[model samples]
Target chain A: MKKSLFIAAVAAALLMSGCSQKKPEVDMTKQETTETTAPAATEVDTGVNSVVGTEESAGEITTLPEDERMAKIKELEASAKKIYFDFDKYNIRPDQEPRVDEDAQLFASDAAKDLTIKIEGNCDEWGTDEYNYALGLRRAKTVRDALAIKGIEESRMVMVSYGESNPVCTEHTRECWAKNRRVEFELLP
Target chain B: MRFFLILFMGVALFASDATLEIVKSTDNRPSVAIQDASEFGNIRIRQKFFRLVMGDLKVTAHFKVDDRYRESDYDAMIDPLLKDKDYLFRYRFREDGEQRLYLDAKVLDLSSGSPVFERSYRVANRARYPFLIHRAVIDFNDYLQMPSVEWMRRYVVFSQYGKPKSADIIVADYTLTYRKKIISGGLNIFPKWADKNQRGIYYTKLGNRPVLYYYNIYTGEERRVITSDGMLVCSDVSRDGKKLLLTMAPDGQPDIYRYDIETGKRERLTFYSGIDVSAQFTGSERKIVFVSDRLGYPNIFVKRVGDRAVQQLVYHGKNNNACSVHGKYVIYTSRESDNAFSSNTFNLYLVSTESDYIRRLTASGINQFPKFSPDGESVIYIKHYASQSALGIIRLNYNEGFLFPLKGHKIQSIDW
Candidate 1:
């Protein structure tokens, strides 16, 4: 009886090994699902709003027809000048502080009182992706803190760092790279 | 009785020599030549597979791979041209309709004129054919009793920018030959494999709040992990897949944080006023190695999980911005230029955490995201030079390197 049991265990182990040799069914099933879903995902992507304003902006922006408010926000955003930064430096440059002051005034105006401000920070295509992102955030934070000091409510502002991915200029020249490292403001009503 | 004898020999061989034995016959490396034995298939795909297999064998650095393509019978006598080679690799490729692919491969000993290794691989999707080649080469190397080349079979996940405000996350084989877009649409960067099995990944969707998400590759399920203001990234995962090292900037200050996936609890690891990001788990998950600008410039630093003290890890570079850890070693990319704008060189360097040993791994170009293979025997990184991007692989034991160019798009970040 002991010998017979030993033989049966060895046979079962061999069968298990043979079954393991075949590729797992999970991969095939997953591959088919990805193939069918990837194109649908791409079709539904629909630019930047697919990720960001999906939840909050739905009930507010779609229902409202305030053309005057929209025009006011657009004008405020256009009037808010871009704040520049030095090569790897995130501190407000001496020359760029005036731009920040102008932005602060535009954001603090009566026309923009009911709106929230989004500070979009950008950088040149240098440094590691993670580091550039952090640096960009610092630039945005500096601008946010400066605006807050100028009486813009801290809770009404949001910051997003594009990190070298959203470069305005794709040139490899020094002048063009300098043009890419700046922060722009967007007003959301 | 036979099984006991085999087990005893295996244990004795491993216990006698703890160090890996890199395959070398006497003082010279073995030579290998490949022959195509496909009965019928797409001509373009066959040629591509031949080139890819040759590249894989050459990158192993354990064999002198013949570059010349030749067609011959899979089981016939070796040709006169390949008579001097040590081994002959034969493969048969077949495709059904459009998607399914099958590969049957054999390795024959030149002197003995007999089959030494044989295996077959198939994939349901034709776009994933590169993995078949990777697996075949890895299996052939293992049959020769050489050092493990199993890292060749891993999937490299990366994010690439498409437009100004658009990026897509993709998964590819180690060679970047087979690519599948896993995540598309708005600003999806910083992809990290959430588990060792490659079943799920964690990435941040750059939006107003910059939400971090965990995506299951098989089930097409995405679970919201967390969200933060300013910046958020899932940098590394623990060996057990229960904890994640994340870089989150809730108050506009990027700091490293350790998050427990099971409990949804977070523990801030760094309290630096300056930039701190890209934290990687090192030495028992009790410690982490990350990048920080607390010393006036970006450099690599390490800190314990519960300790308040931080220690500088790499003292050689001023702009050591990115790092990856394996065992007792850490590999990082250091900027080698005074000017941060325009084009500059970023090279990779290796340093031991326990000793003062340091080694420069790359000579030139922009090298970043140096990821060590699971076995710690190799590293795969991104290399951008002369307006082209390539996937760089380094064999640490052999001190050899290879580059496989990726056309068209630029790779933002990569993890295997």
Candidate 2:
């Protein structure tokens, strides 16, 4: 059983590397600032595994006949944390860095060695669609770079911006807006 | 006849910007009144038809339209009350079957007591009655040899936000009386007409990867154009529909890119580290005008194609975030208040690329997404005030404005 899981893991890694090789390469060294030439890719399909609706309850994961590794992956995703930001700002607050660090540690663990991470950035409904989308992207990018610094492979991550369209809270309050301006984590296979 | 001949000649002499100056100086618009001659139809719908026609005339800024309702036969003598007006407009409306509508309209010169023009219009769907009126109005405006109010005949496409993670792209007439859903069932936004004919549209669907889709309206065919990791929005289509100005963030940073439809090649236009988006082709496609946050807040900037040089277009506001251009004039939305958390009074301003001359088009409310009509004589923008959203139009030549309130829904963006 251990041998089979090891072979599966290695094959997944090789497949991910093969897919990433087809994408236009981004020079990490040159991306330290703005005005760099961006790579144009026709499509970027990260992966198709979503653990959102897998387990109805935390207690149910232990009884499933799935691989122990898949069970552990579900457990990790169930505890995935969200990091919030200030109004009209994308910079991850100093207080939220700890959550980012914790999330980064889970993705780095052996249980999630072959899974992809999808980072979703959202914003409060306060700005124009074009500006809000860009801001949301900035928020997601900041989180992605932070995770990269914390040892998460860049090729295993994908980012998407929901702009002001996906709000968790509909109330018109400052606290609700703050809750809406957040970066969420999703695990993909 | 003599008066209209002189007016038509005046319109020819002064086409666009100069026409506004001439109208302001002369203030000599012909007076016209609309009379409902519908023998049978829904009373409310008949009233709506009259109001829409009057609205179309007023929007033209080429006539003084009477607001009071008057009824007369299509071939009857002009009403005495309408005699004071230079022209008496009459229309007959009826429903045949299954909501089929027919309209026979005529404009009579009250001074001469003879018909100046007459035409019959029909629509298979009663819900689409507004277009028939719009077409008639455009025809009348053309008959007078006035500058084309052709923009009125074009459909206004927009996206209305629903539940979280849900928005639907809708196309409607200028008055918003005619609306049909084009795209739905996900967070789809930024619906832009793909060409001058508006046969297709470009919109973005948000998901694990932001995908931009080009949908043809007539055939209901959809083709996925491109997908980006961070964000992707088709901001503007080139005048010829062969190239597109796209806001795509490949490295998690947003910038403007020009994409060619034929070659599938995208050339990065703006390479700022900060946000650069909402680009519109300007100066006959020689340059592009876009909104960028180079100064830590959104402002308008213009860059020549194939050149790395950039120039700031508007120096008036800190948050001049959205803009649309036609010929030499650019219309943009500027935030007047500093509050970013709540609704701010964002007004529209018109500026000329030829000189430093500036004109304020809107005075109050959260006015954004200012799109210049194809003719550049009018502007249509989204307005939010007092928790209510409305579609607003400004007849630039006449300095007159009109609002058509959208009830129970929030407008995400709009374009023509």
Identify the leading candidate in terms of lDDT.
1
Candidate 2 on B289-311: residue-level lDDT in tens? 98898887888899998898899
Q: Under CAPRI classification, how is model 1 graded?
A: acceptable
Q: Please identify model 1 stretches exceeding 4 Å from their true place.
A: A1-65, B1-27, B40-44, B97-99, B340-344
Least accurate stretch of 10 residues (summed lDDT) in model 1 chain B? B16-25
Clashing pairs in 1: none
Q: True interface contacts reproduced by each model, as a fraction? A: 0.83, 0.81
lDDT of each: 0.85, 0.84
- lDDT (Cα, tens digit) per residue for candidate 1, span A1-189: 999997786667666555554435545566687885553222222332222233654444453558876876787788879988888888898898788788777777788787899988899988676999999999999889999998899999999898988888998898888888898888898
Listed in order, each prediction's TM-score against the native is 0.84, 0.82
Write one digit per residue (lDDT tens) for candidate 2, span A1-189. 999997787678668756765654453433545446673333444432311225345554455445765677678888888999987677879999999999899899887768999888898877786888888889999999999999999999999888888899988787898899999877887
